[model samples]
Target: MCQRGIKVTHVSKGSSSTKIQRFIPLANGLTDNMKSFAVFLLVLRYLSVSHGCTCMEGPQQFPAVQIDAGQGNVVMTDGNNYAYFLLGSQWYKMGSLNLKHVSVGPAGIWGVDLNNRVYKYVAGSFVFANGESLQQVDAGGDGQVVGVTDTSTIHCLKSTIASDYRKQSTLSWTTITGGLMYFSCSSKYGCWGVNSLQNIYFTRVTPSTCGISGWIQVDGLAVMVEIGTDGSVFVVTRGGEVFQRQGIDSSTPQGTSWTKIPMPSRISHVSYDRGNLWVVTDYGTILKCLY
Candidate 1:
């Protein structure tokens, strides 16, 4: 049987009240778990169009130190430095490699271990990437990849090596001006990063040549930055608060202003790709948000 006219109120800061009406189907032999999942989907749909965005509890409960999502694939690293990949709703451990940060994009899957060692996924295992040490790495660009060394030195992967990194004899990196503690690049709008002081910066990157111009400081403070395939930008503050960049198009690559997204807990990191937003909380709890 289907229950009609279920009303849910939308109330959050800076937003007016709105009613979400949906038909919830309840039938015989409907397990409690299934019922809960059904409600979750309904709420997710409602929040997607609400003021900003609200992330609901997901099926995944694993504690992740960092998370990345691309296309429909998700990857993350635990506090113990172990890597895991998500297939459907289950997470599978990826070999025995320990990675502090991981990224997936058009270039492929790349990560850096605790020692800042670079590695690439190949043959179901993470192989050593012949490149300089990088504390953090991102491969979200079309063929553009960028990373930050322990000294905060920024580096961009050479286009030639990025195209055929697997078959390349040696990987090369071009050092970019300015230092950053965190960086993320997008195929549509170039790159954005945060310095040690938490100052946000953006630059137009030449993905085809792996070249970047002078850094332009953006107003605001962020501990981390992530870019979506559609040029959507997101950032996590030191207080675990999250914000999304609005009005980002060809004319306004940097966007207009920040729109706060409601969260259940303090978030440490976030990655947005396709239509899914993956968040890692301060305690390592991972959440997948549909926005």
Candidate 2:
């Protein structure tokens, strides 16, 4: 039958036309082997000669809670099992990722990538996967969507349902004069932007209370910053000094307070996950905040 232009070769003559099935790419990137009757085919056009694709062979799993993808990776979960993966440009099923996002959520539900692309799993549905360039493209959900662009702009897309994802509240913010991966937003009130100067700055962005304010330089070259749910800012700087800021009426590092997490080392990324905080050290060590 002519299904979406692709010929659906009847694998079974006895199979009814109404029962005819077509191979539709998995929307959440999962191999059929993990479940039962599914297949995930990958086509790498660019990184094939460079960073080869790493395929995972296993069963579909769920997460304990939820997960957030970073730049170019995808997160998958079966409600109790969690998996994160970074595929160059190919396709992968559930439980095939490179890093873990214990901070954003459990380890599943949804995921972010290096390019800031996010996706959700819709079982039994065929979905076309997008490249990392699709960041800030679209997510099929409501709620607040935080999008980051490669052009040093942090955009906030907020809706409120699981299906009304097309109507996003997009607010773009430019980074400081320094080059950075752009700014990271919080669903709370504002977002923090890391500038090209390797410094950290964030301004209020809420609607009623959020006015068009300029950047507030926090410090020099923070390794990473995670805004808490209570409007407090936790910033990690060059020397592993963990600084916390309370409100906008503070000068930062001093206006609020500065307390270093006694890790005795520097870290690459500090993530908050599963009620605890995890930090990846510069030497590839994963350290947890002693809270």
User: Quick one: best lDDT, which candidate?
Assistant: 1
- Clashing residue pairs, backbone N/CA/C < 3 A, model 1: none
Question: Positional deviation of 227 in candidate 2, in angstroms?
Answer: 1.0
How many angstroms is residue 102 displaced in model 1 relative to the true structure, after the best TM-score fit? 0.4
Per-prediction TM-score: 0.81, 0.47
Measured with C-alpha atoms, the lDDT of residue 287 in candidate 2 is 34
Candidate no. 1 TM-score? 0.81
Question: What lDDT does candidate 1 reach at residue 54?
Answer: 39
lDDT of 2 by residue, 113-221 (tens): 4434444343522222232222332221123434345664554433332233222233332222333454444444566656545677666544323232566676446
What CA RMSD would you report for each candidate? 8.2, 18.6
Sliding window of 10 residues with minimal summed lDDT for model 2: 41-50
> How many Å off is the CA of 66 in candidate 1?
0.3
Worst 10 residues of 1 by lDDT: 1-10
